[model samples]
Target: MPHADTLTVVHHDDTRTSYTDVRYQLHRDGIRIWSDEGEHALTDILMTHAYRQREARAS
Candidate 1:
């Protein structure tokens, strides 16, 4: 069965004029599995996670 997963935006900075800094965390079964911080939108983060999962399953 798939693990129960949760995505959370732990930090966000909108003060920059060029881009926003978004920090995110991914938790599986109530434990942190991954986390990253960068100038990325929420959709970008989600898509990245999806891509990683797909690649993992393929390999």
Candidate 2:
């Protein structure tokens, strides 16, 4: 997975190149994760919980 500031070249060849933007956007009540599959919109509470969960696992 790529962080918000990281830009990745997901696909590249002779004729075409594709770059993936791993960034999140903050909104009034939620955050949005851009993806090729679909955009994931999470409320503030859920975003906080996800961050906490990742922190707990890292610790």
Candidate 3:
């Protein structure tokens, strides 16, 4: 089992024939933080995390 506070990514391919129909869900402690079907979803999440970390260090 994953840790309670662990961030997890659940991915699904809506169409087996192509990679364009993809979905992503971001969860923490079994609760969803956000979900997106766009191709840039993972990149957006990663960048957001990086931005938060940088802000935390600056404070």
Candidate 4:
């Protein structure tokens, strides 16, 4: 797991790259909010859920 206040690079094999800043916790759920433009909330939510689903399978 990444440490608090760290940055993680997000990328896609096809063609995409992004940098996510680990912001504060989301109500102690250990869910960290990635620093990004709030205007992109829809995309953020979708991407986050997809990532979490993949992690679940890997685990």
Candidate 3 residue-wise lDDT, 1-59, digit = tens: 11122233333432222222123244542222322333333322221111111112211
**Would you estimate the TM-scores of all the predictions?**
0.17, 0.35, 0.17, 0.21
> What is the TM-score of candidate 3?
0.17
Reference-based lDDT, each prediction: 0.28, 0.39, 0.27, 0.32
Candidate 2 local distance difference test against the native: 0.39
For every candidate in turn, the CA RMSD to the true structure comes to 10.5, 13.0, 11.9, 10.6
List the candidate numbers ranked by lDDT, top first.
2, 4, 1, 3
Model 4 residue runs over 4 Å out of place are 1-13, 22-36, 39-59
Name the runs in model 3 displaced over 4 angstroms: 1-4, 13-59
Error of 1 at 36 (Å): 16
lDDT tens digits, residue span 1-59, model 2: 32343322221232321224344566777655666656666553222211211221221
Judge candidate 2 at residue 41 and give its lDDT.
64
Cα distance off (Å), candidate 3, residue 15: 14
The reply for model 2, stretches above 4 Å from the true place, is: 1-21, 46-59
Give the winner by lDDT.
2
* Candidate 1 C-alpha lDDT tens digits along 1-28: 1221333333234222222222233444
Most TM-score-accurate candidate: 2
